[model samples]
Target chain A: MSREPIRDSVADLLADSGLADDGVLAHALESLRALCPPEAPEPSGALADLLRYGSEAVGAAAPSRAAHRAAEAAAGNLSPRVAPAVPLPPRKLHRGAAISAAVIAGVGLSASGVAALGGVDYSANPPQAEVRSSAAAPAEADASVPGQASKSPDATVHQAQAFAAAASGGSVAHEQPAAPSRGASDNALAGDGAAASSHAVAPSAAVWRSERSGAARAAAAAADDALAGIGRDDAAVTASQGAPRHRADSAPSRGRHVAQEAAAVAQALVAAGAEPIKEAVALGQQVRTVAPSLAGLGSRH
Target chain B: MTDSLTDHDLVAGVLPETELFSRVYQSLAPAVLGYVGARGVEDPEALMQDVFLSVLPRIGEITGGVAGLRTFVFSVAHARVVDHYRRVERRPRSVDYDPLLDMRAVPSAEAEALVRTGQTDAHLLIGSLKPEQRDVLMLRIVGELSVDDVASVLGKTPGAVKQLQRRGLKVLREMVSEGVMAQ
Candidate 1:
């Protein structure tokens, strides 16, 4: 018998049955092993690099405090079973008390505005400055209040009452809560200013958008000039020493004029009673009409 | 320090900087490197380092002592290789090789001799097989994994792996015989 056939049969048996128990298959496998030997060659420079990498990784493995806590938590080592129990008070109570105090002060001011106003020296406080501005700028004040009042009529009345009480000396203690209302007014002023500025820029922006004719281009340039004039007037008004420095700090220079205009409206609402709320609602209607005109001008330009 | 200590015993407490780790590294590093290198990975050594580093952290989790440890290490190596390919896919295009710049001005005579006669023949022969066949054969032979272990690594049934191994070896044997007859 040719050894080739025997070798072939052995190879077939080894392939079929795997490396178990057949002496002939084993012999064939061993002989063929030389053809495709196991690659046991040590990777040159790998050992050193591996050692270095492992050492560095090991060195860096020391957990940070937060990581250690997290790991402990993951392992259930930091579970509540291991923790000490202590009763903790709710924090919301303190906030509730502050709000109650502010409400009481607001009620007092609304109940007796003349008495409250007489008790406080207006020149000493910046908010008192707002009261004076309200008298000077009733239309603007009426314009700003209705939008806010419409959102929450009851809250606006309460807020106006709070401002009146705040203007009066209900409790200097309630000033902290009143600070947030002042901040709200500042934000409202800034928002109104931004809306007006957007309106003023809309026509020029439309000209740039269409680029249809010389008339449109000239209109765009006129709008730009008008915007520039507004900006210069704002700078002059803001620069005035007697003008409320508080308003300048509350809004950006670009929105200073709009902010001042809105601030005057806010002051009028605060100083006057519920009567201004109706006027503000009317002014709000006027604003709605004017806004469409501004948007239309942008397209026409 | 004895070789007789089971992998479970070695990892019974906190993992130590003991001789056991060194022994395991010495025994498995070459096989792991070979497996990674055989796959034509860009950096087999770095991947091998990753495999070992990953193994070190999770050695305690392994059961079945030495055998389990071996399976775990190879599994980690396989996962890392898959991750490497995934990363290569997501990365920006690799630089093209310039033959003029890449070619050695003067090839090392010793290195050339090693390439001609040393391990390249076996690697080249193994490379000739289909990817699945090649993986099964290498894991079985070089990684010294059992049929089941190879199946797990390749995500195939034991029967499928056996068939692949059988087919791969047969093709290898034929190629060897043809090379011999030519000579």
Candidate 2:
């Protein structure tokens, strides 16, 4: 145990080297015991005080062993370990599936909407079609009634007498012919008998007569047939209403007026029949086209 | 009171309320309290109590028998000292040694003797060092820890701890010598 020479050698090495290398210095220093401080004597009464304080404090801070176990049980810390989690699909695959499902659902919803619009019977929904038809029917009925003068000889003769009296500047009865009237006849005849005779003859009769320009005349005739087909005589109505006998030969202005009158009458009749039919045919075509697609969708489901 | 209890026997609560636990408490608490006090902690006794209370539950996990248990207790004490300073938001200062106050108001003959012996002066000098240096010195001397154990508790490399120990002791020795010279 008397390693004095070794200690002295290490100490001289340490002093000479100025403790350059930490390992050697530490090793040399460990052998020199006096360098370390002596342990201080324990202060009196300190141990007893510490023990008493520790016993009380530890008792207060930590519950008894049984109570601690109960606490751990209550907190579920002592419960069996939980089962491992279910393995999830990879993130990219899951996301791709979600996006694909969303796209498919969107397409299906769009197709369903299109099918509902095309395939549903809109006419069966009385509130929609019936309201439209009810509103339009009265106006059409009223318009076609005056044109019916062609079907009633007496009404035609009455119109004819009125026209001749209007031409001669003699007072005569101005009646509405108990029929629906258009602007052409209404403008020409809607006046007192004396006023009708006093005023110059309406140029609407000349306008109708000027419709003799080939296809334009054919169009006028077709309009007349449509009127008659609906129980309104266009030719008789025109003649009785004093359609100009010779197209008002000198008044080129009167010819333009007649042409405008004829066009108005034709437009009113065509709108009454053709517009609804065109819509119905278009709807029928749509339903026929989409019905197969909807059936296929149903089958797939 | 045998110091030879196995780690398993201690950890299994076989020593609770036993003479062995009392013996262990008696053996370690004083040094721990002294170490805490020398750190200039506000409540050294309370901190020592806390350190022992913390050690009680985990006695079973301690390895290396009595020596390991001693290291564990001191480690708890060291942590408590650090925590005290952190909580108070100020570093521990050197205790002012008033020999007049010590001699006149001695509560007991033992306190009077302790004060007369200049141990309080030694503690004041140790406290005057930087906190890390004080920690290295205190743990080495009062906690009776090896340099490696001090490093382990303080979370420094063994080499660094040795350097701190060497420097701190050198400064403490010089301070003590100066006080003696002044006296």
Distance from true position, residue A242, model 1, in Å?
A: 99
Runs in model 2 with CA error above 4 Å? Answer: A1-59, A63-301, B1-17, B90-119, B176-183
Model 2, span A1-301: residue lDDT tens: 1234234434443343355344533342333333222332332243334344544444446633433332233224212357658766688549988899999999999999998876634332324423433344444334444443222322322433333333333556557432223453345333334325434544454443232122222333333332332222223334344543332221222222222223333333322222232332333234334433433332222
True contacts kept of each: 0.02, 0.02
> Every model's DockQ, to 2 decimals?
0.06, 0.06
lDDT of 1 at A62: 39
Candidate with maximal DockQ: 2
Query: What does the lDDT read for residue A231 in candidate 1?
Result: 52
Model 1 misplaced regions, further than 4 Å? A1-301, B1-15, B101-119, B180-183
* B1-183 per-residue lDDT for model 1 (tens digits): 113335555566544544445556665776677778778798787667556654654445556577666776777677677667776888966678876456666667986666666654556576678988878866776566778877766668999998998888777667666673232
lDDT of 2 by residue, B1-183 (tens): 112344555554465444454556666666676677777776676566555555654554566666567666666666666666775786555568987656466478886566667643454565558889877766665555667677867778988987886677566556645653232
Residue A38 CA error for candidate 2 (Å)? 15
DockQ score for model 2: 0.06
